[model samples]
Target chain A: MPVTLKDVAQKLDLSITTVSRALAGYSDVAAATRQRVLSTAEEMGYVPNVTARHLRQQRTDTIGFIIPSEGPRFSDPFFNELMAGLGNEAAAHEFDVLVSIHVPGVEEEAAYRRMVYGRRVDGVVIVRIRHDDWRIRFLQQEAFPFVCFGRSEVPGDYPYIGVDGTLGMYLLTRHFIESGHQRIAYIAAPPHFFFATDRKAGFRQALAEAGIPLEKELEILGDLTQQGGYLAMKELLSRFPSADTKPTAIAACNDLMALGAMAAIQDAGLDVGEDIAVGGFDDIPPAAHSHPPLTTVRQPIYQIGAQVMRTLVQLVQHEPLAQRHIVLEPELVIRKSG
Target chain B: MPVTLKDVAQKLDLSITTVSRALAGYSDVAAATRQRVLSTAEEMGYVPNVTARHLRQQRTDTIGFIIPSEGPRFSDPFFNELMAGLGNEAAAHEFDVLVSIHVPGVEEEAAYRRMVYGRRVDGVVIVRIRHDDWRIRFLQQEAFPFVCFGRSEVPGDYPYIGVDGTLGMYLLTRHFIESGHQRIAYIAAPPHFFFATDRKAGFRQALAEAGIPLEKELEILGDLTQQGGYLAMKELLSRFPSADTKPTAIAACNDLMALGAMAAIQDAGLDVGEDIAVGGFDDIPPAAHSHPPLTTVRQPIYQIGAQVMRTLVQLVQHEPLAQRHIVLEPELVIRKSG
Candidate 1:
């Protein structure tokens, strides 16, 4: 049986209210009384009822992370690394990470509402921001504490840490243009994502700088998955039946898609890094291990996850932040693929 | 401002106690009064205080999962897939999944204690069972609800869902033996893990049936990481300086280690499929995409995660479980690596 506050108070011959207040570190209790209460509680193996204490303090000491996923089949290494960062940091601070998976719509909103209105968590960490994200708006409206991994286009200030996708894509695209490749293609993520829009702008910026006209046929939208990238590349190849009319280079918004594009290229009897230069973003673990390897834009995903969690904690505690909005620079990693 | 029970009672012209009892669905409350209270509360947008309700009901409606990890650097796609399954199913049932990462030892024990005694979670899902696991013992002694992913060596009846590692390894090892490879090596996981012990037994069982004497030098222990596998393979190669004396076939306990062994083989100027055959377990997503692809034992990790959670929920609710203990068969997936 677990020791309760009443049991401890009875053993110490003190009032239950006094023992509770002393254990809670309320200054109204004498210093010696507080010390005595702590020692007695420890000796009795008294583990405080966290739910009861949280109700009194109006704090759960939990961080919520609602994964915006398609379904149960969602498997992204990026989320794995990010979750490790968030969970590790939260655990270090004696906070539990409460997680749920919901698509970005009514269900997702309800999950967030439950966490906020029900006081299930102290704060939340938001990822994969969409254009004019309603999550941000809802959190802001409720005055709920949260930190985002990406920024939204909504005209409001919020705390966030985002990678410079536009700059990352620009660097990769510029590398292909400088390599004397005039016929370059890009596989993009869904346009609903904010990073997708930024990345596409970077691709165009590089093409415009080289005085190359943007070809609608060269740009394809993918679902940010391996299969999606494979189908998009197959469609691009089918549009140009002849070898000479095929793209000389392809840039994927993510590593999974890039890997799929590489597979499609190989199936088409085109050698990667020779017939078609391929590059990707978010330098995941497999990026370095792929055949011929992959040239990619590197972002510190784990670090960002950790930082976002730290910021959310600070926000929950009403502490002043060092920076409200941070945009991190992405680095280009040169490999055999590009 | 959030609507409260007091406001609902006042609007409905009922006593606070009556309103509360009616909202709680107490049998003593009159049916017409209950209907009026419910309609008034719904119209007023009254979101009940979950913490207060949980305190009264003695239920948290939260499942705990403590990830046994090295640190923030831990990146495993297997966990990612499992988490997706756990989180998705839990959300469908309106339960939140509480997560924390801790190395196995005192810190991990404290995490479990806090979740149990502090009433932070209604039930816990235990993974990566160690031999004679103390966690199971503690939870059992406390009479807390828990479902394990693997069984401990400790003699007791417990609810668990485990993959048959012994059979999985036996089949892989037998395949190598039939392929005319006498000089086969096995990279084992740490001995403390239950699956590691089972897998090693299977490896030895296959060798014994073939009348091959167990060579201590041919079996190496790996930390179940890519780096660990790489270093173990390097040590195995260093032991036998000549190509003829080195292992012609290698089997790693997990895919990460197998991939590392493949890298080491390539570094030694040996072709993977032609010169040295490699096999791995777990058949993670990277297994299929790996260079030369990995021949591995496939366990439905995502489904297992879902099943574990479902069983845990049933345990917590005191519902009759369909199966108390389940041992699933693992399938052998052959690819180019072998």
Candidate 2:
């Protein structure tokens, strides 16, 4: 059997309560006694029962992030970067990050309930907020400390840090118009996502402001994947077989799709920038080095990750937040592709 | 205060020992008594004290994977895929995966110690083995159950699943030679990695069999990153100012570097497949969609991940294994670039 609190207390000739308090980092215990107790416990191979400690203290010292995965595999670099950012910052704060990857459905809901009702985490960071996110409602009902990477349409008082996707898309579309492209097209993400709705709205608003009539044929939906973009672009191309009728510029909701669009253009024996200007949102690492390079809207995902964690930490500590809702500006980056 | 075991027992008019055993899912408890205890606990909002239960069972139902990350942000899709595989498989087995991202050194060592000594996880899955991986030694000393994604130079009786990197490299090199290329260059990963040594040895072996002279200038070391590959390729180009002296083919250690090399080659006013045959390892998703596509060696990373977890679960349960050392074959996929 492993060494226990009782074993340590007996070895040190101290009370069990005193030894427990010392190891718990409670200031009520003498500093020298705490040191001796810690060293002896380490020497004796005393592994702390974390579940017990968490039960008594009502804190796990761990933050949780449940990936809103849709399928069997998730390969989005955006999440990878965000996770790295969260993990690094959480580690710096002496906290561990517990990541639960589950497709959004019954399993996902059960995961949230288990983590919250079981007291498995101190707090959580929610991402990929839907139009009517049930998680926010559940978390709020439980009075749980949590923060969102994206905001939901559901009315609630909660902390969130969101990139201004609508404005970013507006800026990108405006840049395309300024480049003397009257016929422009947009490849959008599935319409249910909050960012997808916001970004498409921005695109439409820009076209209306520019006195360019919105063409129903030009706006196509993509599954926010490279293959989805490729198929959407091909469909868009098929609608206008002639150079005079086709859109001179295309804007995708993400860089991966934009890169795919570029490939589609190349496959059609057309020069990317000269024949068809293409741009994407979220200047992922590959955008800068893509063939002919890609113009995109840059979101500070790393900083957003750090900020989200800081807010969640504040909420966990029951500290007052100066501003619960943070909207960071997105930057427009013009390159050879657009 | 929240409801406790005593409160549930008093409410049900039952003994505390019966209530505890029922909640613990012990078969000794009568089915009817367990049902009554569960319903009462749920009605009273009695969240099971996981810590106390863990203390009695000596299990956390969690597996750990510490990423040997070496930078501010890690964006490799390889790890993302592997993580998805591990997470999905572990979830199927009613286990949670706890990931810790830390660079290899003092902090990483401390993380292992903490996870092991704190009883935070039941077992671990190790990745990215090096020439002298200290993690293996440490885990062995603790007698902790672990399964490795890669093997270390330090031989030991441990469970591991490794890809045949040496044979894969030899095949790739031989393919280049069969295409009538005498001056083939290689962009290798950091020398400290065990795969790097094995792959480079294969490259040398292939050239020796072909009766080709080995040129020290043709071998370059990259940091297993796109930027590293870009810089290494640039350096390789600088060595040969004339077209006649430059290498006719190039092989990168991974797809990211290979893509970077392709970009560098394009920037130098040269066609990828025609001017210089370019290939990479790992067959990452982008490799197939890259401009001109990339020839690569494919390692079944997803399967490898699932297999690693299976072996780990077996070890954790102290079950007998048919074979502990599993070496999976790597396939050479020929694309336009090579």
Candidate 3:
């Protein structure tokens, strides 16, 4: 049988109400009495019921993260690394992370509401932000604490840690141009994502700087998946069947897409580095291990995750933040592919 | 301001205690009164405080999963897929998942205790079972509900969904031998893991069936990471510098290790499929996207995660489980690597 508050109170020869207040660390209780109550409770093996404690304190001491997933088949390494960082940091702070998976729509809204309005978590860490994201608006309206992994165009300054996607893409595009590849094609993420727009702008900026004309047919939108990249590359190949028209280099918005592009290139009887150069963004683990290796931009994904979680914790605890909005510089990782 | 029970009581012309009890679904409350109180509260935009409701019901409606991680750099796709399954299934059941990270040992024990004794979770999902795992013993002693993703050597029957690692390795080793590879090297996971023992047994069984004496020096232990696999393969190459004594085929315990081994082999100026064959387990997403594509044993990691979670929910709810123990067959995914 588990020991209860009454058992500890009786053992300490105190009123149950006083004992409860002392155990709860209420300032109204005398320090001597609180110490005595704590010792007695520990001796009696009394484990305070967390649910009841949370009820009185009106705090769950938990943070929430919702993985914006399409389905059960969601296995993005970026999210995995981020989740690891969040879980480790949360554990260090003696807090638990409540995780859920929902696609970005009605289900996602319900998940967030369950975490916020349901009082299941004290704060949330939002990732994969979109332009004018409704999630940010909803959270702000509810006055719930949240920190984002990317910026949104929702019209206010909020706590977020964003990587400069524009700079990342610009570096990759410049590398391709400097390598003397004029017919460069880009496989971009869906335009709904805020980062996608920034990356596209960077690509255009690089082309414009090099006095190269932008070809509308060379820019293809992908679903930010390997299959999407493969299809986009296939479509590009079909559009430019002749050697003179085919792109000499390809740049994908993310590593998965770059990998898919490589596969498509190999299937088309072209050597990756020899026949056509390729580069990617995000520099996922597989990028380093791909056949010819991938040259891409690096984002400290795991560290960013840890930082976002730490910011969310500070917000929940009402602590002063080091920086409310941080834009990290993206680093270029040069490898064999380009 | 949030609506209070007293407000609902006054609006419905019932006692506050009656309204609270009605919301809590106490059988003593009259049905009409309960319905009236619920509707009036909903109309008044009253959201029931979940912490208080859990206190009254002694149920948190949350499940816990502790990721046994070495550090924050833990980016294993196997766990990612499993988590996705667990998260999606939990969401479908309207149950939240509480995740934490801790290395195995004392810290791991404390994490389990925090989830179990602290009453932060109604049940736990245990993965990466060890030989004679103390976690299973503790959960059983506490009578806390839990379901495992792998079986243990503990002395009782428990609910679990496991992949047949022994059979998986047997098929892979047999394939290597049939492909005219007489000299084979095995990269094994840490010996403490139960699956490691099973997989080793399978590797030996296949060699014995082929009448090939197992070369003790050919087997090396890997830390189940790509780096570990690379170092292990390097050590094997050093041990047999002569081409005549070097292993013709390398079988890593997991895909990450196999990828590392491939890198090591390539660094030694050898072609993967032509000079040396490599095989791995747990056909992760990257395994398919790998340069030559990895030949591996496929474990339905996502499905197993969902099944384990479903079983855990059933156990927590005291529902009759369909099976107390399930050992799934592993499929051989023969790719270009082998």
TM-score of chain B of each: 0.93, 0.93, 0.93
lDDT against the true structure, per candidate, is 0.89, 0.87, 0.88
Off by over 4 Å in 1: A26-32, B17-36
Error of 2 at A317 (Å): 1.6
Per-residue lDDT of B1-338 in model 3, one digit per residue for the tens? 45677888898888989998898899999899889988888889777667877888789889999999855478788889899889888988988898988889799998887778778789999999998899999988988899999878898778999999999999999999999999999999999999999898889999999999989999999999888999999999999999999999998998999999999998899988889999999998889877688999999898899999899889889999889999999999999898
What's the distance in Å from true for residue B297, model 3? 0.9
Q: Give one digit per residue, the lDDT tens place, for model 2 in A102-127.
A: 98899999888778877778899998
Q: Taking the tens digit of each residue's C-alpha lDDT, what string does model 3 give over A1-338?
A: 45778888888888999998998789999999999998888877677777887888888889989999855478888888889888888878887898998888788887887677778789999988888888889888888899999877887768999899999999999999998999999999988899999888889899999999999999998888787788999999999999998998998999889989998998898989888999999988778877788999998888888899889889999999989999999998988888
- Model 1 interface DockQ: 0.76
Task: Return the lDDT, model 1, position A294.
Answer: 93
How does residue A140 of candidate 3 score in lDDT?
A: 88
Q: Against the true structure, what is every candidate's RMSD?
A: 2.0, 2.3, 2.5
- Candidate 3: chain B TM-score equals 0.93
How far in Å is the alpha carbon of A183 misplaced in model 1? Answer: 2.1
Q: TM-score for all predictions?
A: 0.96, 0.95, 0.95
Interface RMSD of each: 1.4, 2.1, 1.5
lDDT of 1 at B29: 92
Give one digit per residue, the lDDT tens place, for model 1 in A1-338.
67899999999899999999998789999998888899999999889898898888889899999998855488888888899889888887888899988877888888988888887788999998888888889888988899999877877788999888999999999999999999999999999999999999999999999999999999999988777888988998998888788899999999889988887887788888999999999988778767768999998888899999988888998999999999999999999998
lDDT of 2 at A281: 89
Q: Which candidate should be chosen as best, given TM-score against the real structure?
A: 1
Ranking by DockQ: 1, 3, 2
